[model samples]
Target chain A: MMRGESETYGSGMNEDKAQRLEAFEAEALGYADQLFRVALRLCRERGRAEDLVQETYLQAWRSFHRFELGTNLRAWLYRILFNVFNSGRRQEKLNLVPVEETISETIAWDPQTPQNIEDEDVLAALERVPRDYQIPVVLADVEDLSYREIADVLDVPIGTVMSRLHRGRKLLRSELTRYAQSAGYQT
Target chain B: MQVIDCRNYRELLDSYLSEELSVETNHAMLRHTEMCQGCRGEMAARRRLRAVLKRACSTDRLGAEAEQRLRDCLRRETAGGVAAIGWGRRLRRLFEVRGLFHLAAAVAVAAVITAGIGAWLYGAFDGPIARPDLALSPALFEQAAGDHEHCGLKFAVLSGPFEMPDSAVNYDPSYAGLEKVVAPAAAGLELRTVHLCGHKGRQFAHLVYAGEGSLISLLVTERDGKALDMDQIPTDDGIAAGMQTARRENLSIGAFQTTRHVVAVVSDLEAEKNRLMAERLATPLTEHLRRFEQQTAMLSRISFIGRR
Candidate 1:
């Protein structure tokens, strides 16, 4: 009787485990596209972006048992994404940024200039900013993650995240300005 | 409303543009913006840039194809292929697949061939016999090498013609009637053990010989699995022949096709010497194998009669 009861309990536990796995894919996989977009900006390369997103989801699935029931799931996803991204952080992140692209020489913001740069152009310009300043800018401005969230991803303080975001945006503006001038646009 | 100073307003610019600041801070920032022209202009430009970026990045995503790919990848991960298998067991399963088995077999064959070649190459060489379709079977060399390893190099020096062992009593079914064609070719070497090794339904004569400090072998078979990286050398005692030789690992192999069988001589002999020996044996081999095969049907008939 004891053995039969134990078997019944074991089967119940297995069914519960199966249900959790099913629930995870249904509920959590919605964030995968968002994670991938973030990964694309972070890596600045297509293949690496896919790899990063896959790794993030794979890790999230593996660590699903530790997750609290009802927290900020997106924020949690970002945390995990950043952790995975930074863990295997590339030494040379984006090779698109030219060597001469310091902020002082590139951007001279005038209110009179054309502010009609395309978003793809903006992204291209964004990729040209140095990696140190670029990531926080992407997180705060593009992905809409908070400065605190960026800090968790980057393993830096919130103050540092804000500073980097500001600097990164400034660099991006300058780069877009240079890109515009080169393309013979009035901006 | 309390107006914040420039330093504080500068820090709040990012928050304000992102619209994360509260109404109190927003009101203060507006008041401050009215006062500071430089900060206000910088903030305006940054706000425009941020809006453009936000709009763009919100829509920025993997394409439909990549999305499908990721969906498939996730599906595969969640699919019940082996949910209960632990990490260790899963990895073991990966290795147990047929592709990995083929890879292991190929690698083993390569290692054996490499060891055979290295053994010959490191010691000595002159050149190889330039021959067309002179393919050496690494598998055959490996078989002989295994048998040679089993019995060390203290083997009898072969001289004159040797007797063919009885097939039904001594050899495998696939190898029956094979000894008559093989013994004469092996008779000149410092013969060790005469073996009939069968692999994958193909039969071979694995004739081991004591070669220098290492044991060598002559594996003769009717089937030749075309070898790609065979070394070219002259194989002739005046029969139109081409010799392909190679050193794989510790053994040097010399191969040539006769009228009846594909003959491969693999040994610890120097590359040049191994090929020269194979070349010298070609005439005797061609003659003996042809003569033996001519009588093969008669012998089979006699053996059948004896069995009856």
Candidate 2:
């Protein structure tokens, strides 16, 4: 009788575990493609980007128990993605050297947005932006992440995120303007 | 609220566009943009730029093969019971089970604890557990050999005068002049073709050489985790310490890892000859890759500092 009872209890526990895993798969796996798109820009290689996404999902799954339901799961997953990406290069986190904030501050002129800009030109221009600023811009503009969400994802102050996004957009505009002038397109 | 000026409008424009401004500020922004055509136009232009960026980036999606691999990896993680559900909860669940299941659970938990202790004792957690003898998947060997057979030999048969395209630099700037780096090492080999090609869903900078009626393929691919059995442990010079050799059918492959890439030499030569040729090629290639890695790191660091 005790043996039968134990077997039933064990099966119940197994079923619960399976259900939890199934729930995780249903909720979390849907974001893989979106995460992969961002990962591609971050790693700059398809294979590494895929691996990064895989690692991100694995990390997310491991901590799935801590994740709150009905909250912004998308942002949480993105936060984990950035965490995985950043953790891999922990040694590169060197002492902060203060530098003049010249790039964003000096944009005295608002260049008119160019017309007929190829997608390739825009992507190449975005790639040229410094990564520190590029990430925020991509998060806000491309991924549609809010300033607060980007701040959480990047582990920086919200003010820093806003400033970086501002600077990154200005830089992107100038790059687009340069491309337009070179291509002889009327802006 | 204070009356908003042109400077304040410009400063608030991005926030307003992002819908991050408070209601009062948003109303002020609206009033200002309504009166000022310039701010409105700038707002429209910025919105257009954001839409363009989103459209461009959306074109890239996860490849089918990669998605399948991710699913497989997650399945394995689940099957292995590595979901990291806390031990306390697990123990509680174990106790919730009655007689025979309790014994079984205790035994399983004891075994896991023992294995963990043994692994810790062996210093397996010190870094990536390096299984030097079999450091890469057999599929990778087959993929390298397949690229050698299909890309190297078949292209050699076609015998088109192939020059590395300028667009290869878009994939990796190092690919533009890669032949120059490998040329000295390949003394007697006739350089047949060099191009960036994809095989079995992985991209490689493929350089084909012909010597003594045998075709050799030097492939450099990004080191995704599954490409090797262990996480790469780079030495002080930024290249993994030693060569890893594998054989697939008639082909012999010898590979090593730089910080970001895997460099392999695939040929139908005897194991010893292939190993020797791989060693010869590995030196210059590893050195070149190390320098490139350093330069990239330095450039990113400089950019980081500049941005901050």
Candidate 3:
């Protein structure tokens, strides 16, 4: 009804609106599977993830006035989902990292650091990474988001995102290597 | 091509492999990767890690239930005959007790105000009135009484047979009074309504105040005589004849005449209280009428010039 006055009150409004909405849905619906997947990972629960995804789509639709057509819809939706997750009052957990590496600037990563590994179990490894690190790494690798986009989505400094990505990959690799070994894979 | 050291290139290794760095930065990292095997190895490992994670994460899809719920949400938003906030529907939470209660209260208040204003405008005329010489005429009193009763019933029942046009709804409380003059100026009082009413080619400002379970109606109308005559009530400065108070069927009515108009208060309170309220209202309402007449004259002159 807010879209057009003629369509809202005129005789042919219903059929016209149905066609317009169908066109919009045709474009927005394909991203649902990906949106649910990311929200699921962010929330770590089924119920909350559904809510986050639903709100994200609804918000995207509401603010479609500002969205320029033919841009990266997936990234736009992800940004909205990330905002919902961060703004929602989730329980804070102190994910203890070694004091030396807690601050990104203070991290001392080796260029060719080695981990003892036979194979990789990336799914289990992804779950173990702290939320701060996991979000940037998953956005970067899984979603193919660039460093700046990851920073924008996570609402952190570019330098902090870079630090998280480096550390997150290292931690994920170590955990995956452990999972692989237990599963008797040699790599 | 610019040369780059291994340490800096290693820092930019991920961005370089992903081609996300700026062209200049990407060029520098490329030169380093081409020359240094160690940096190249770091880049390779990152690429492999990215590939594996992407594959594993891509496999994750929602079960049937979540998909259905999402579809239902979409259906409700897109085509359910509900007005969308923008292109999408509002995300109103289920079970908003406080919100619903506030909405109902707002509707009630709106109904009361509309009825009060409507009654003051049209419900107060008795046949065709004649120009009377008295400050407070019996005909005017009869009309005010009818208005009070009609508006009171409408307030109690929240529905009426009257219909108002869009132009008739132009009453804003802040602008209801003369400049810097408004209702309920006294303490422990609340304004019920203030409206412009008309009868027999004369207009009256009908201001109603309610507080302490008592209702007061102050009517200001044009005065045709210089002196107010009401049982020869004594006057302070010859304007507020506060000594004159009369009873009309368990209701106390009092009147005062200023330089240009007569203002009266009709209430259930004591005669002295009614006189005090009349005294408070009479002076300012007279001043407002004087200013309003001057502005109307000025506007007419301006429009006459434009037409010429």
Candidate 4:
């Protein structure tokens, strides 16, 4: 019943519109896996991550007209994902005061890189890092986003992204080193 | 090419791995790593760690059922033509004369229908009508009452074994010692539980109390966008004033706003009694929150000056 409008339009017009939507879907849906991976890290729950990804795609579809044809669609989708997540947690934004001071102090003591660590241990260490720092780390290290892109996704200055990444990596390294020591791995 | 030391190499390694450095810096890094075996080994370890993390995280794919659901939802949206007209064009068309008049008429009709339907739904034709002057969102009252009923009274509307405010320091630092602040005013009531809970996407530091065979919830949440309709009420030296009252169903909600938070007292008590309790509970809590606000303001101002 909702598709009644399609019958009203001529075949040529409907075909062209259908082609455009298909093109949009073809381009946008390809990144669902990547988006879901990042969403999982951000939400830390399967159901919430799936919902976040769905909401991101829906929002992206609604605003697809504004998106430039040749720009980075992946970054755009990520921006929308962060926007949805942040808006949902707007109340929590009040507590997001910069913890750079404490984090910077703690990161001064860099641990030696640990060896023979399991993949699970690495993930556990990454999870142990505080969320503010963990985001930049995942964006930069895991997702392979540049500092500029990470900054753009997070809506923070490039310098802030760099510092957060630096600190987050250090925290991860320390966690891994601690894990390695407990598991009797070489450091 | 410029010469580099271990310190520079160590500092730039992360950027180097992320491919953020310029060609010149990359060359310098390569030259240093070629010469310094220690830095090279560190680089290898860091790279290996990055790979392991990526591989571990990549294991979590969108489940097949979820993917199928997403496809179905998208198909429905496409069929419904929801995204055919862009929101910008729709918004622009809203200001057209005919569109504006039609919109106004529709809103008027909708308001009347909503008021009548709402009265019928609540079965409270004589219940407290929201004063137009106090432009608070009606949802705020419903959310507070719903939290009191579902969370405080265990109505099964929200999942439970909720966390205490002490454990919620990661969410909001002010929640760390909130019970101590309200203990003086809540002396008579038996404190049932103090926990951080959320209802309808809004987070609350909910402190439930029991007295006179009734359960009361003292909730504190960030105003976010749910601010009072009136001009800013002056807090005379950290003292809370202007307790706004509203009633929903059988519950009375008396609320006040600080610079950053909305504190409400919701219970089945009479409106006047709820208002009195709100004043008592919110005074100390308001003073406490105002201090946090002032500290935050001063910290930001100091940081602003430092940045300049």
Candidate 5:
């Protein structure tokens, strides 16, 4: 009698696992566009963005058993995408920040002018900000993660998240200002 | 309401926009904002920036065509086709076959040609060859021991012509076959089984021999892996020797002067074991070289001895 019960329990567990796999596959297909959007924002290329999303989905599918069904799947997928971006391609991580900040102590630049810039120009400028500043700004402004949630995702203190977000935005604004002045746009 | 500086207000703006501020803090921040024009302007600019960024980042604008293609590709990936394996994974799997024959076959028919050439060279050079002293001199050995806590030279000398391209010097798989022939002969020499990475990135079996400290490394690069027709000289103790070859069959040998040592890379010797064993068998090898030199000198009256 005990053996029979154990066999039935094992079969039930197998069925549950199969059902979960099917559900995860469905969710992955459904949210692929959103995941691809986040990856596209980070990578700025279509093929690479698709690869990043696919990698994220595959990882999510494998770990779906561990995912809490009630939690936000979008946030979970975003976290995976961010991790992929940070790990970067097999090649050297390209310094996303513009050449100026990277060589700053070596060279000085012209000061303060505010101007209106195009969205793409602003993004190209935002890329000039260091990743430490980039992460929070991208999360809070673009992905719309809360400051506390950003802290949770980044595994940093909320204070640190606030500081990064503030610094990130300021740098972004300065970059926009620089682009605008160069393009002959006035604030 | 407490008045906060622009810096502190700047920090709160992200939280406020995201609705992350606590009820009391939110209310206080709102009251402060109403009183502070500078903070209000900063907040407005930041909000505008955030809106622009959100709109810019949204890939919904990539539109239906791109989205459909991406979805179709993803659907194919999830449905389990060869596309899901990825290029890198597939390439790695291509080389991961366990058996030797399988790997050789997968590498191409060149293995068969390499085997044939190797067999022919073995047969041709199978004649009586003098053995050199296999171990380093006692003084040099002790010095090498002192400099290195753990050091050994793993060397293989090939007598046959190195094949070209895929079959050349370091790329030749049989180059390491000398180790099996020599290690047992050098028993009690304190040997270590080193991981044999292939020469020119081709895999080979390797070993290192150590007594106290000194190390000598012998590696072969497939001739095809690099441009050929160059000389190699190993110098250590006031003596140097070199070997060069242009054609597959012809090898040039010589003794050279150096500040420290005289080392020779034997290119035409069939057995690396014999080359190393030549030291222990020095009396016979010296006699042979002397006789050979005498005959050459008598024929042309040319000085055959290499000057120090």
Candidate 6:
């Protein structure tokens, strides 16, 4: 009877571990794509981006039991990604220059056009903007993050976020114009 | 009412487009855009540029991916009790680094205080005119002759005080020099006298020459309490006239306003050299106005040719 009780106790422990593992796996799978995209923007390389996302997942899994259920799951994931990016940024020691405003000075086009410039023009233009500008612009315009949310993610002051967004938009506008002109499109 | 330059309207355009401008300003921008071709064109262009950027740099898909990867990584690591224990230890260490954290926190606090003070002063003194570009007036062109009578380019005035920071007058800090910046219109017209007041209390004389086919202006600021000398005046012989009824640097002008006064000449100077010359003249005039303001302690003011 004592031997049988020991076997049951051991089996119970194993089942509890299994259930916890299954729950974590499900949550991790749900957040994989979001992690990958943010990592891609920061790293700017697909493989490295994927690896960063994978690392983030690993970190999340290790801390899963501690996570408060029903909290902002997305915000939590973003904070980790931002930390990873911040660490990488510090290591690289990026020194970025502020963008000038001349790029958007010309070309009077209307916003209400049915179909505007092509996608290739835009992608090509975005590649030219510096990483500092690229990150904020993408998060604000593409991801639709508010200025405050962006400040939280980037871990910078809201003013910095606003300035960066302004500078990035100006640079991108200039690049787009050049791209359009080169593509043989008229003013 | 005249239409101001579209360049000055850039800031307001952004605010208007963002829907961040006050209701009054928004109405002003809309009204101005409807009547002014240049402003309308600029607004259209800015909108287009923003749209182009949006389409070019969409990151919705990327954000989603990043979120997913983060969760995955965290889940996998936490599955192992070993990883959980390590993170718990790291958190404890973070708390232990109290001294270093306090130092960093203090610096951040100082920076925020400084920024806040700077922003507050700028807003309070500027009187809701922080950005000239964003101050585009919404009123449709108010003409003496009704809509059918083609009134030539209405003179839109962008005027303000010429305040001088001490640094500008002492040495020339890059920022201090703006104390002497002025936008004095010098096309050419006969007036008893034109009073161009800087924020500090500098004044100048101006004239508008509204010719049948051309609109010319000549502005003379005081030099040591006297009108500018003849050698400083820009005349028709020196300027090249064109069909848009425009001319470039129609005259070469040199005038000495008092130590507190600077003179500016604005004409239809399309030539690069003429524009530079005008800017040089206007910049000094801005300074003269600054000195005048310091002596008098009066706010910047503008006197219109016809009605206020």
Q: What would the per-residue lDDT of candidate 2 be over residues A90-167, giving only the tens digit for each residue?
A: 443311222367645545655566756778888988988877777778888888888998878777778778777777
i-RMS, every candidate?
18.7, 12.9, 11.4, 9.8, 14.2, 17.7
Best by lDDT: 4
Q: Judged by DockQ relative to the true structure, which candidate is superior, 1 or 3?
A: 3
Q: Candidate 5 residues A49-126, lDDT tens each?
A: 666665566456545657898887777777766655555432423233323333343223322324354679767887
Question: Ten-residue segment with the worst summed lDDT in candidate 3 chain A?
Answer: A90-99
**Local distance difference test, candidate 2:** 0.69
The sequence of per-residue lDDT tens digits that candidate 2 reaches over residues B1-308 is 75687777876777887899999999998898889987787778778878889999999999788878776665544433422233234334434454656466455445444544554465422223233322445556777888887668753432212345443455566566788898898899777666666566556778888786788889987654346433322222325336777777788888877766678899999888998998887679878877886776666556545755
* Ranking of all candidate structures by their lDDT, best first: 4, 2, 1, 3, 5, 6
For model 3, how does the per-residue alpha-carbon lDDT over A1-187 read when each residue is reduced to its tens digit? 3445435433423555556555556777788777877777877887767766776775566455477879877778887777655544334321323234654453354424233332235677788987767877777878778887766666667777777777776677666666766666543
Which candidate should be chosen as best, given TM-score against the real structure?
4
Best by DockQ: 4
lDDT of 2 at A151: 77
* Candidate 4 Cα outliers beyond 4 Å, as residue runs: A1-17, A91-107, B82-308
Please provide, for model 6 over B1-308, each residue's C-alpha lDDT reduced to its tens digit, 9 standing for 90 to 100: 33434554655465466555567667767777877886776677767765666665444343555555544433322232221122223333434564765665565445434533554454421222222211111110111111101111222111111233221222122223232233233323222112111111222233233322333333432222112112121211111110001121232222222232333343434444434544444545545544544433222121111212
For model 3, the superposed segments whose C-alpha errors exceed 4 Å read A1-13, A92-107, A111-120, A177-187, B63-65, B80-308
lDDT for each residue of candidate 3 in B240-294, tens digit (9 for 90 to 100): 3222345566666666544344566667777676667655655565555445544
- Which tens-of-lDDT digit does each residue in A55-106 have in candidate 6? 4554454456678878756666676666545544234323333445454543
Question: What is the CAPRI rating of model 4's predicted complex?
Answer: incorrect
Clashing residue pairs, backbone N/CA/C < 3 A, model 3: none
What alpha-carbon RMSD in Å does predicted model 6 have with respect to the real structure? 30.7
Q: Lowest-scoring 10 consecutive residues by lDDT in candidate 6 chain B?
A: B139-148
Query: If both were scored by TM-score, which would come out higher, candidate 1 or candidate 4?
Result: 4
